[model samples]
Target chain A: MDLFIQLTLTGLTNGAILAMAALGFVLIFKASDVINFAQGEFLLIGAYVTFAMLAQLGLHWTLGLLLTLGVAVALGVAVERLVLRPMIGEPIISVIMVTIGLSSLLKALVSAIWGNQPKAFPPFIPSQPVKILGATVGEDRLWAIVIAIFMLGIFSVFFRRSREGIAMRAVADDQQAALSMGISVKKIFAWAWSIAAATAAIGGALVANIVGVGPELAGFGLRVFPVVILGGLDSIPGAIIGGVVIGLLEAYTGGYIGQGLNQVLPFIVLILILMIRPYGLFGQEIIERV
Target chain B: MLTLNNIEVIYNEVILVLKGMSLQVPEGKIVGLLGSNGAGKSTTLKAISGLLKPEDGEVTDGSIKFMGEAIHHKDAAEIVRMGIFQVMEGRRVFEHLTAEENLLAGGYTRRERDLSSDLEMVYSYFPRLKERRHQTAGYLSGGEQQMLAIGRALMAQPRLMLLDEPSLGLAPMLVLEIFGIIKRINQEQGTTILLVEQNANLTLGVADYAYIMENGRIVLEGYPEDLRQNADVREFYLGLTEVGQRKSYRDVKHYKRRKRWLS
Candidate 1:
């Protein structure tokens, strides 16, 4: 029972972080129909930039977090303006290829600046153990869960209730129709890119807070694919649930079944989902009434 | 309020769609532009609304002036902000969004933060939309989606509303219902409308003045009463032949194309 409790808490923490990362992926995909391959690189940049501020520059962690987010937003806007904007009206496959190129470029830039070694992250969220529900959990892990849920909640509300959020969704549904309504597709694309970056940065920061920042941190982003696939690609709630499910599965497999199989478990689920439910558990069915 | 002066549109630098299409829409009145398929009716509205840019269509010559300003250079959002909203053909509502959210999106350019009054105004115009407000717009019936599209236009509170075939793909009765509301929207809000449609009979019924076009140019223009009495309109558009009319198949083919008017 104690082992189960410990595994569940750890799983929830990882799931929350996965949810944060997938949130941005869904946003960009929903708004622009671009499958951003660089989303993982975004995580690397976020982790490295924050590490630079907190460790090398000796800035306070809060200020470091803010500056990292600012950098993320700028990165997002610049990418959309410079790379994606010109590709408008191009074949969707070509547009997707551009994103793959972008991921490579960003990854190269990060290593060029930060080097190939992992750096110990500044102790922002203390890793001191905490007791919760009769199970011991790392303090950073608990905070990660809290911060992830908070970020996800704010965005869920934003998309559901805010005017601009609704406009963004409208563009996702139909670009020409949204334009006719005076919703600028260009502006919405910019917003999607920027916000997606900000969320991924937060997710990156959370993961860094737990594990030290490194070039290998990008590998953490690859794990997000299973979450996004399990969740509907465009559904925010789906991302949240999928994150938790994948996280719990990973924790259980590692805790009980074995060590190596845990890492491979998400891919197995991804294959099962693709074969059984291509749209994901909560994805839109792509059916149009008229 | 809106005037297009000999505007020629070329798509992909070739495939000329609109050849010197010219028309004028006066303030506070309904102006109907009647044309068959491929006569550049939809393209004309796209030119006025600046939706042409997206489709690689350009207004290469002449100018479009709205409210006495040269607007040919402006884009769609700028034109919309200047108080001209277009209800695009085929009722292109955001399928995933709820009906109410689609309307809120139309209010994107409005200066005021509070939109309850505008939403209420739209609901008053189309009560059916308010009932289906929470329903996903894609799942709505064809007629209901058309209403939502028109309601979206109204949410913008546009001064000059350009409607492209509001009656397309609906029952005759629903078309009549939509036309009645359109006339009401114009009269009540003093919103000038440039209506482009192939339904000449219904358009002529609602329009104060009308223009008939063929091959991307206006072939006839007059008050509805005058256009209704025109022999060409009666024979071709209204399908009304005179008593003891002896029109042959050749005449029928000629009436369909009506190339004599181009001269």
Candidate 2:
């Protein structure tokens, strides 16, 4: 029972991180139909920005976090305008390739400035351990989980209740109809990209605290793809559930099944789920005619 | 209040979907566009709404003036902002949003005003939509989605409304109900409409002016009464038996009169 508890808690912690990242990924995809390959780079860039604000500028962690999210949003908008906007009417493959290229370009650029080395992340939450149900947990992990859930909750409200959110959803459903209804799809696209970037930034910074900040922070973007697919690409709840499931699977595999299996489980599950339910768990199924 | 003058749309520089299709919707009038399949009725609507670019022809070949100003080259978004909206052929409501949200999207351009009264008005036109306001639009039946689509457009407070086949995929009773609402909208709101329909009976019943399109061109044009009386239109559309039989105008007129009495 203790082992199960330990595994569950540990999995919940990791799931929280994946959930945050996957939320951003799904937001962009749901609103714009663009599979953003550069999402991981946004996370990595955000972490490095927070590092720069803290270490170089001597700013408080709180200020650095806010600055990081803001910069990340700006970066997202820039990328949408410079890369995604021009490729709007292009072939889907072309759009996907452009994002892939953008991610690589961002990686190279970040490495050039940050020197491709892992850096220590200072604890945003105090270095205190909290004992819950006879299991000890770090304050940062608790903070990370709390913040992740809060952010996701806030986003859920924004997507459900806000005018811009509804407008963004309209654009996603039918661009032409959206335009007819006086919804600016371009503006919605920018908002989706910016919001996704902001979420990624926070998720990256949180993950950096859990595992030391590094260029590999961006790699979480790729890891999120499977989670999103499992959840249902367009379904917000699916993203959260998919993230938690993947996180638990990873935790169990690392704890008992083996670390190698941990890496392979998500991919295997992703393929199987896609074959069975192409739309993801909560996603609307699409029927295509030849 | 709307005009499409010499609008030419070519697909890939080869397939001419619309060739010099000119049309007009006078202020506060419902203009019905009738056509067989592949007759470019929908394409003309698309061109007017700025969903397609006319590279092979010119809107300036004459001039497409809306409210006395040429709006031919304006973008779709800009055109919508100028109080022109389309209820597309399929009633493309946002599947994920509730009927109310779909209506809210119509008032996307109207940010400051309270939308409740407008909502109330839309409900008056489509009571079923009011009942299903909280339900996702995708779950609505075909007739309900049509009401939602029209309700959404009404929320935009358009000066000119373009309805593309409002009666498509509907039962005859629902068709009458939709046409009734459309007539009410024109009579009550005085919103000018350009209606594109495959159902000639419904079109003739609702429109003041009518245009008959064939092979990407307007083949016949007249007032609804004139169109109802035209021999060519009667022969082609009113109904013709394909057997080796010849019919005179008098016989066709008598048949139409009898049918009208029965209807």
Model 1 chain A: lowest-lDDT 10 consecutive positions: A281-290
> What DockQ would you assign to candidate 1?
0.82
The residue ranges of model 2 lying beyond 4 angstroms of the native Cα positions read A1-3, A287-290, B13-15, B53-62, B240-263
RMSD of 1: 1.6
Q: Residue A224 deviation, candidate 2, in Å?
A: 1.0
Report how far residue A41 has shifted in candidate 2, in Å.
Answer: 1.6
Question: Per-residue lDDT for A200-265 in model 1, tens only?
Answer: 998888788888888887776689899999997998989889999999999999999999999999
Worst 10 residues of 1 chain B by lDDT: B254-263
What's the lDDT of the predicted structure labeled candidate 2? 0.83
Ten contiguous residues with the weakest lDDT in model 2 chain A: A281-290
Instruction: Evaluate model 1: give its TM-score.
Output: 0.97
Q: Write the per-residue lDDT of candidate 2 for residues A1-290, one digit (tens) a residue.
A: 66677778888888888888888888988888878888888888877887788777888988888888889889888988998888776776888788899889989999999888898877676747777887777777777678777876887888787778888888888887887777777789889999888888888877777776888788788789889999999878787888889989998888887779998999999999989998888897652212
CA displacement after TM-score superposition, residue A17 of candidate 1 (Å): 1.0
